[model samples]
Target chain A: MKLVGIAGTIEDHSYNRTLLKFMANHFSDQVDIEVLDIQDVPLFNQSDDQTDGAPVQYLKRKIEGADGVILATPEHNHTTTAAMKSVLEWLSFKIHPLAGKPVMIVGASYFDQGSSRAQLNLRQILESPGVDANVFPGNEFLLGNVRDAFDDQNNLKDDKTISFLSSTLKKFLTFVTTINDMNAKVAAADWESEDLGAHGHVDTTIDGLDMHAADWVDQATKKTNAVSGDTYVRLDCGVLTVDQLNYFLNSMPMELTYVDANNQFLYYNHQTDPENMSAKRAPAQVGNPIEDCHPKRAIPHVKQAVHILRSGQTDLFKLPVPSDGSKADMHYYQAMHDKDGNYAGINEFVLDILPIVKYYLGLTGQKLVKDPNATDALTGASKKSDDAKPDDVSGASANTDEAPAEKPAEEPKPDVDSVSGASANN
Target chain B: MQKFIAMVGTNSTNSTNRKLLTYIQRHFADKAEIELMEIKDLPLFNKPEDRKVPAVVTEMANKIDAADGVIISTPEYDHSAPAALMNALEWLSFHITPFIDKPVMIVGASYGALGTSRAQEHLRQILDAPELRARIMPSSEYFLAHSLQAFDDDGNLVDEQNIKKLDGLFADFQIFVKISDQLKNAHGANYEEVRNLDWNK
Candidate 1:
């Protein structure tokens, strides 16, 4: 298969770049791979897409010609780099070369655990409607402690790593070949002349075989109806079922633990991914007395907060939890009340506010841009499903407000110095 | 050799509080046998059912029972110790009472300016409860603030003041444990007399 390997970093000596190069060279016998340089791809601007640039056209043509795309990405602040997102934005708006294209993602990081989060995020982006890249499921090639994993020649040194990468490549190749063969069979099938069932409709026959599309649709509709029935509770914003409320709670970056007014540990949201969660809640802690949840040493303080909230002295209490310096830890306790303003429960929000704190403090070298097409310009690579519709593309557009702009064009040292100086007085 | 078990409060893999315990173990290498205990595996304390005791809890109790003294290096979360550490303590307090009359020292490392002063005070209150009846070292409270910067890459305490304070605290703890052990062994009514003796001089 002819593949286009996109190194998702612009750094001159990026490990991700070297990793892609190594993959291209090592897998030369099995697949024809060409590494695409994204350094000269101008920052994504929706207004300028109508007047295509040479580099943009070059990237689009290369992607169009390739049978599969390989993304080797570097993570920044627990997400994919801004540079990688910019490339996706430029490609997604117009031609949508990624749509129905076979893609695979891999990443390397200096930490003991590689860039798994970034790879997950990238898969989400690729699967989104506009991109619609057929990302391989459950295959992650994370080269951790990458500096030590590779040799002086930019080749992977460890036999185990090389074997793992080789196996993953083989699996990806099989997946691509299978998809291509299936598509070819479906295309060659004469569906027009196929028998129409009793309803005088196409019988959902594919390649002279029954697809059972009707049964699948019926089951899906029934499941959706069953899930949405009378399980909803009215909220200020809208009606939400217990499952929906849990989804909203878990969707938040923070972990939440709730204690009722009677000082009972009521509930905690089950984290979707335990590895990514900073705080873990065991099931046994639920239904226990709130006082019992805390160490005896901290019981008095827990009581005081409850008492204060019960007495209507304060509605909220906030504290910054100490961290090991990698992330900022903040805790917020809000007094929950009933419609009659009676104290109902206490809700605790444990958040890693380092990103927000750093952003405001200007400690982060992230750039901010103001553009009308900003929303469409950068979409989260997440929120894609295997059957995602083409029209479902708009929903995945990332909120421009949340996307950190590309890093400043110049050196970052001076910016850090000035920002630190400004923050010193605060 | 006097064996001391150190329990760190937080379950974070990158916990600075755990790093502080490692620093303590290194600093007091010649003084006592400091065993760094992990509370991550201990199930949450539940009544009646947990009273029968899981094998893991039984093992934890056994270790505590064998140890001469206990050291707790904690990080304050929501102005208290994390749930994992508390759960372990509750298990011990309920089933074993191993902390009763045990010489326990509390030290904390935090990212905040106050370190874990509030948590230490709260812990002291808990240890002094009638059922637990732990004899805590009251002379000094080692609260390391900005703990991320307190240690070097090699896990050694970098600040001279912190190093000096830890040195004194460990020495005082050793003396405290020795006296406490002597008092525990003292025959029937002699405990009152032994407790009144001026060990400071």
Candidate 2:
């Protein structure tokens, strides 16, 4: 059970590195762990190889000699520290010390989720071709609310959390033995294989240019020599000019969008400017891959919704876009099929149904009242998973700015010029 | 025309991410005024006991405070943002809150196919932190994969599609900047919260 530990941060004072030191001493009876420092590991650059550098050599020799390694990472910008990543880059480049080594991940953060994202990212990086290491699976050694996790003696204070950590490490010792004995090559996870970039080509895909290009409309038009202006175009139901088709689609009550079968955002109705529209759509956003039009956090949900519609699991998937106000927006994703019953694309339409409901009530001369048995979650607004809602992110400081408590000031503000002088007055 | 601060999020002497930012600046010359900033000089953030921010960081913060918007082009290292960029952010969010409520656009370039996908995602979370609170442009990303081959001899972007993507994103970013001004309801509360932050607690 010989192991080497490296904290993901090079900060002068880091809870993650301290957590590693605690684990090494506390679990000395069960396992032998040596803590390493990344204080002098410079930022990684391919042109500036630090393989022969003293700092890198120190860790490389130790990692190569160890049976397993434990990475206690700190979450920075939702991932492992750049210092830790730099160390990995040097080790993986021209020297594969981490290759085939057993690795376990643990992390601590100021808030909850204790570096969850960073640990996942580290696993991905460690399993990469360059730094191919076998990572222990399933156990999530998360130490959240880490500021108070330790006492003055530098030992973990929580009995439950400490017991959990002890058990997780015990499992890790077993994981190391099993992995080292079998040396099995596991298949990639289900989620890892799916590419959201939408790079795969179908028959209608335009290959010459990037699908995310800003001028895709003009370029695609030129490439295809598409008819425009008053040019006549034959439709399935009738014949009309290009201008007439545009006028017809734009005049629709709901904002329309077309996402092709290949997951490309091919078209959207832009009758009004972005500021006025219920859902903003820029002309330049017309030909982007679907993922580009949404924040990274929403990608998983986007893929799920598309899959349900694409796989013939459902003909229509409706979502209520949440809003605090009475703007009860509704979004519908209707599946469009080709003549032969093949899934072609989605015809998504967005509209505020509140007006329609109001109109109905007015016509009927009726009043509106809340139902006591109604579930709020079922009818909640702001449900568009693709939308970038700030609430979705963990805003840790949302409430901390309230009236300061009467406790003594932690760090005297003699640091620099006052940043929020006006805030004090308010 | 809008004014912007374009930050090269890496310290490497030879970085395609820097080249990407340069391309954005030159390509959008007619639409906006763009000034490129480097994070290389800022030291790695160690949370000095004095709580004093470095002079260079203060200079950068002042520039960011004055700009209408910011464009950050990052290079992915080991599936996350480079330490140099994160180090710079650590200082920016420490005491000076220039990023607070400022309009920001995230773009990236990579030597491989993923194009810094994870790093941009990670950066989004960091910018969303209470201390930073940057109003990142919604629903848009510009990932320049195979960046080494993405540019020409004059540093102009070689691929027309990537050029268009950057163009579209920049155009959207301008609109986003204007809209950010309307989201001032939380401005006061945001500053107050940041000022009272005690990370040690």
Best by TM-score: 2
Tens digits of per-residue lDDT, candidate 1, A273-334, equal 54565554555545455544545544434444455555544566554444466876555667
For residues B25-48, what per-residue lDDT tens digits would candidate 2 score against the true structure?
Answer: 888899999999998877666668
> In terms of DockQ, which candidate is strongest?
2
Candidate 1 local lDDT, B1-201, one digit each (tens): 789999876555678888999989988889888999887665434334323767887787788889999999877643444434555665666535577678999999998698988668656766664345688998679999998888888999899999999899988998999989777653333434333422112
Candidate 2 chain A, run of 10 with poorest lDDT? A394-403
lDDT of 2 by residue, A248-306 (tens): 99899999999888888888878889888766789998889887877677665566556
Worst-scoring 10-residue span by lDDT in model 1 chain B: B192-201
Give the lDDT of residue B145 in candidate 1: 99
User: What TM-score does chain B of candidate 2 reach?
Assistant: 0.97
TM-score, candidate number 2: 0.59
Clashes of each: 6, 7
As a TM-score, model 1 comes out at 0.32
